[model samples]
Target chain A: MTSSSRIQRRAFLGRAGGVVAGGAAMGARLAVPVATAEESAGPAATRKSVAIIPPVAAVAQPVREALAASYQIRMLDPFVRFDQSLEEWAAGRRAMGDSLRGCDAIVYAPEPAPDRDEASLDELTRGTYDLLNVAASQKVQLVVFLSTLELMADYPKEFEVDEGFMPTTDTSVRRMSLYLAEFACREFAREGKLRCITLRIGQLANASATPASAGPLSVSPGEVARAVKAAVDVGFSQPSRLANWEIFHIQSSHSQARSSTEKAILQLGWKPDQD
Target chain B: MKVLILGANGYMGPHVVRKLAPAHQLRITDIRPAPEEIVNEFPKQEFMDVDVTSVEQVRSAARGMDAIINLSVVRQDPILAFHVNTLGCLHVMRTAVEFGIRRVINTGPHFAVAGPSYEQMDYRISPDIPPHPGIGLYPLSKSLGQEICRTYANQHDIQVLELLFYSLRDRHELEPGTGGVPFLIEWEDAAEAFRLALEVDSKELPSRCEVFFVFGDIPQMKFSNKKAKELLGFKPRQDVSAPWKRG
Candidate 1:
């Protein structure tokens, strides 16, 4: 058996645009032209409704307050608690849909919590999809997902870690749960369901609490808020051909920072004015 | 070696059990209890009702087992799809680590790796390609589950082999052409890969995690079965390509 017969290269493109666009949404959502809101354009055309999803209500306050300063920040009250029974989840799904309607963008920060067990983490990962489904159905313009810098924590303190650097292999239910949530969001973006930007923020502590884990890369809590706002307004960076899925690593400036924050500053036009 | 089959109530699980029963002791589990025939056949054997979504139950199932084969999955129902197919893998891997189990055989459909995207380009398709599960629930959920198993295998001392099948046919009937699933595998041929995966030496695998596209040879050979053949020494006893031949 000659190698030529065993492997023959055919002369066909096999149809361009092979079926990846209309993911899980099935058929219709692809045809419905999604609404696009200008990135914080002119004089207050009724401030674009930007919803903040902080997993538990306690995950992000500074980020919420910062976003609230500029846009209409809608906090999903009670949150989508999937730990509840199936009956509750049925109602919760509907409630989550109700919460996301008419939003221009969403900032999903499913950060870790000390009290969250493995089951709750699983719930949070799935709940993220439910939230994005509603957001996509409503034709929400953009989603700024707040992932963590800790996921890629294996590199040296002096290493120049970019957004493209593969994350750590940590399979703890907590870390893997967050990574899986990001994976789902990427498919939605790749399918053009909605414009999504994942901001992997560095370790941060609010006004007077000790940092969660000691690290050379201590980000100011306020920088995280600014990154979220800038991500919402980054539409100005590219008007005609904005990428469907983009990732930016934002961290405070340090003499010995672990990961580089150059992309966030250049693309989102972010600032590093330490509070 | 003792084997534990999680989600063993499905159509394929019984065939796998039938093949392994004589040589290996088995424990089977699923959301529903085993079928009556299996209960009667494997009388006095332990059959636990396990919901793969529950970590507690998954952990309990892995205890005292040498190897685990996960056949559980949910194709539709958006909510339950991710919970059962995606998180189910996480629960199983977590249990494997807790119980110090060394090997796991995870199963999913070929579409999980070769979705509508890959289907469009039809030649020499293999499981080595990056998974573009598209947006379908079954593919997306199972692909994510594979990712979890891959991560677990890379991080820990467990060896994970993922078997991706397209369609399984009856040997006697020998249906040809890509009717339902584009690729076809004889039922016995598909079930036999599990035994090869279980018995293969850990040193033979190129990495901690390996994915195999399990199917028999076809005339067009749109999908390649070479990887499974070379790695696990899988041979399709049934002549799958014969029906495609013209007299």
Candidate 2:
């Protein structure tokens, strides 16, 4: 059987419990020790090709810089823009498949925007479906899906809303779109069509210029991009710890941090930069 | 009560309309016109052409209604699935809030809450737990709508009753030995559950949004329909466990 099949088979075997205990939505994740040099999945000797499919160019640049040295990065904004007519989506999806042909993995980070409305959700689903379809067809090795921490904003402020906690989202189109997009991602991962690492980042702000909305939920874009790179790099790190699907909380360790990035820390070797 | 039934052309819509028509004032709306037989059966019932995907259309269709029963579902197409299954929900709830309609009945397959993630491993799962709607587009999209309904119910005064079902079989035609169905409800029995949901007082419910697994008493013990029985007083008339035969 292929590696993908092994992941698929493992998907059924490890889930003795429904959802991951520490991580919220990922199917099955295990606690494993760090791999030795020989077990390093992603060797830095040769840079791999990765496609960064963010919601916009603004979010793509930081991630590009983070992965520039470790992997050759290409941006595919259309895959997550959620702006396409039915015909346009279908045609663009076919074109997007070609764009993914040479990439080893895809980083699909779709953040909710202020301008996003309810009507754009159809496009959101279509875009995500297109990405997964194209990624599967093109034999992309992995897909790191970026979700938002806002989905869990409704949890009590004093509560420690770790990755294990269930996500709570409101009816706004912005948050709902992200919530829906994550579902699509979960399904694709469950099928084992593509190994996925869903990083639910907290209030994402630029490393240099903090957005006004930054607070306890704040995690610098630099940290998020680094997490994305670690998600892509092979140390045999995640394939061993994560099931075909894995969800990890990505955020800074604030005094009042809402999420726990323990799974990301152990599984992906993702560490948040403390300042 | 003046009820607005959206997507009244699906499999279970006719059954609900048939059951509710004599007592309640229903304005049935669907993208396609109701069959001549249905229109002819309830001459006094109002019928309109409306697509749930369009918020404006749903809003217009919901005018002067006391309650709304949303049965809109699109399982197949990639794009239309979200349009109808996911976004259609937002329109329904927004309309409910706008019209001061406090009662809304939402429907979806059991996988909307208990997908492969739960079904294969967990037995006797209840609908109240956190939903783990895995990869299938049909369930995933519909579950998204379910959440939207829950949000509206919690935020607004609207009462959303999500009745979940997986398999609907003719009571007499049930195949033997599980028939690859973990949960099965009689077609008519499933329709009756909707009526109970519609009639149950919103004040008596545990919360503004509640989920119930609407199925018959199956022998597989794969799920618990006790919540439906206790809350909505939903009792299946058919012997749903006949397929197992106790063999």
Candidate 3:
């Protein structure tokens, strides 16, 4: 972190640049046209660059496609293997810092294997912090952290949650890790140099799968992609609110009464395209 | 003024003792008994053995002090680290409030904010950077200690000044660097920072809980001490290498 007085305009540009032309057009009925470099020259850079960490997860495919269609995309593999030593972790952080340069935004989705041991989970936690430090160093405008909504798995059958709901009593490792990630992001975001958006996603269905008839809450990969787009768009359009730090619950509209997507809709101007 | 120094046997404690002994009535306590040399030298000052981890001992040691400076820490033992670093801080703060000690100085390493993993070594760090997760046990516990300070300062009628120190070394020592980390401060400069922190008027400080980075003037500095300079009148009298230039 630089002196507060010397924090560069790139920090402001990263957060407020998108709002110059697109502020008034954002809301429930947003129509974002694919902007070209020439069209977005003044304050709005048409070709913004996004770096996605651990880029190959199945849930990220739609997000990658959506971002690629609109912005230049950089895929970063933050090598956070379970077996790496502290030295290797530092080396990886240095490498990630190199990749973060010139990027306007970053999407971090570290998909640890389900059967990963405690050591692997610890590494994943460190990796996430390393990524944040690199992004903060580069002063990336927006960071979309993809976290699981499984933290709320113990909620009663019809319980609905919003961004304001607290998970004080939960002690599960998955839940605690997500909470820690959010806390770490808040540390950077509170400084106003960077904007952090946490999307606590529900169970991810196949990109092409239809809505389940009934059972558990799940969202298709494409819907997840749309949620990511909405988060980025909101970050750009509403610099005052979303540009600081905001978390939203994301699920397909079809998921019956298990989780609430109201905050996502009202806050980020996002609604699942599929019912 | 009466000042209580916790963890008075650490590396930087003697320097602080030397600086403050001339003006203030000092009471120095640590888990280890105060050395006979310090006791003989500062005959007017009081020295005792008190474990900061014990709330009763810390409270008893803090009874008559106008202010408290907590320097006690455990770096290696994971369980003792939290007990002494985090919970001990809680004890200190609670004792301060009970004793009507309005001004408190909490000492921690730069790792409390910049993290020990060397992840943010490339960037210039100020007190504002959030504590990176997985900074291992020592720094994590110290960071938690800071949070405790913040909580007490906000909820109670006490003012807390947290001074985050970087490499405490002598002027002639080769700059400390294991893997590209560039921040360092001389022992004298760090002790001076503590003295200045103690001397700064409450009116000059902006909030009840404030943090400042204390390090020497190194070129292309990795950690900025501007806040310390501006608010606490900190002036580094030592020069260290610019890590970026060395490589």
Candidate 4:
């Protein structure tokens, strides 16, 4: 069998095995008829439904494949665009919410369009915050907010960045955004109402990336999808009690930023077979 | 091996103590009497009162210990930064030579050898990078600390390894709405890194003084553990957020 096939098979079996193990541990009372994937004794083929919220419809095709293969994901196309008209956006937000209300989980990858942030960065930030609430009020089991890596450009001098150390305080705008999302999620998680996982994605290698932005430090749509699957089914690193907010930066195996990427490969079990 | 750690009361001090306790006969020396409360905390170890900057105090603490790990520094007093980092380090190195200690592991920030600007670049600040202190007493003092290792390696034949780490967010979560990930090392991972550093053979201490970054294997952490993985064989398994898991 091809290496990629082997990996996919292994991933499937591992996930399937985990569910079966969980069910078996729960005893006969919890046993259910779970059909394993044919042609391979792997995890059940049944996929979990996921709702995706993006800023615009510039949906990367590879990302679509990864999510569809692993999850029963519902894509809210023509991604949300915020303009001067609040009323117009509200109608759109409600439509987006109505479509997503039935999914088991929500995934947000909001990329502010050129016009969306013309009003101001604050408006864009607030608009996304409102979208998150749409998911929280519905009590989705999991909400994964995609994010970016903690690049040096992201922070001012006050917060230091080292591969092996954490700066005592971070004053970066990028860092601040992540903290805000986690903070919002914490209030909801407090009542055991919802679970939130913030993914600090690396630079993605899609048509969206320019010559100046391509490299090892970036992530791909496919990689992000696999990561989302890993996070949703394989499970996430727990939420912080300091507020149940968790953050993860997703990057592919070929990150151009040498040491940090190498460290990720060795430490976390993340490796990208595709470029 | 028996190890002595100075600054046992500081932020990373107790962690060094806990990490080394399992394999080495650990002797911790702080400026003040390690509080009864804190001493009672790590039951299997011993504590001593020693002002690390003093030659005599450090010399006394050096007796019977095979190596020393220094973490104490002058916080507000920038002038004193040189004294503790340079002179104080001189005292520890001299004492180690006199006592026939085989190895010494020093704590330095990753920036000790690189500038804040270099952080954005795609490179690892290996020990080979010339020590470059940008601004701030902390980085400068740490640079001097790196120099101390160089001096000891050249003159006294004492082997020293400097460990640099960042993204260690065990103390507080990044405030909400920030892309700031919990790039943190739990108290456990911090301890383990030091433990591995303390155990490495003096001969294994790479010539020209080496720097290794240490921290937990969080997906979003900035500090990379690549070198530590190769040299110390240290792998951190604990996820700071894992303990918060629930159905």
Which candidate comes out best when scored by DockQ?
A: 1
Name the best candidate (by lDDT): 2
TM-score of chain A, model number 2: 0.75
The DockQ for candidate 1, computed on C-alphas, is 0.45
Per-residue lDDT of model 4, residues A12-115, tens digit only = 32110000000011111111111111121234345556665542322323445556666665655422232324455556556656665656676665443223
Overall lDDT per candidate, in order of appearance: 0.73, 0.74, 0.68, 0.54
B137-182 per-residue lDDT for model 3 (tens digits): 5676687677667767877878899998857776656444522445
TM-score of 3: 0.52
Lowest summed lDDT window (length 10), candidate 2 chain B: B171-180
How do the predictions measure up, each by TM-score? 0.84, 0.83, 0.52, 0.43
Candidate order (DockQ): 1, 2, 3, 4
Query: Could you tell me which 10 consecutive residues in candidate 1 chain A have the lowest summed lDDT?
Result: A9-18
Q: Write the per-residue lDDT of candidate 2 for residues A1-275, one digit (tens) a residue.
A: 34344334323322111111112111111111111111113664566677776425344667777777667666665532333456765666676776777678888765444354664555456457667877998989788888878778888776767677777677676677777778778778876788888888776554343333336666766677788888877422533656777788887654445666667777778776644
Per residue, candidate 3 scores C-alpha lDDT tens digits across A118-161 of 33333344455556767878989899988767656666765555
DockQ for all models, in order?
0.45, 0.43, 0.03, 0.01
User: Which of candidates 2 and 4 is the stronger one according to lDDT?
Assistant: 2
Alpha-carbon runs more than 4 Å astray in model 4: A1-275, B42-44, B120-127, B171-183, B202-205, B218-223, B240-247
Cα lDDT for residue B113, candidate 2 = 91
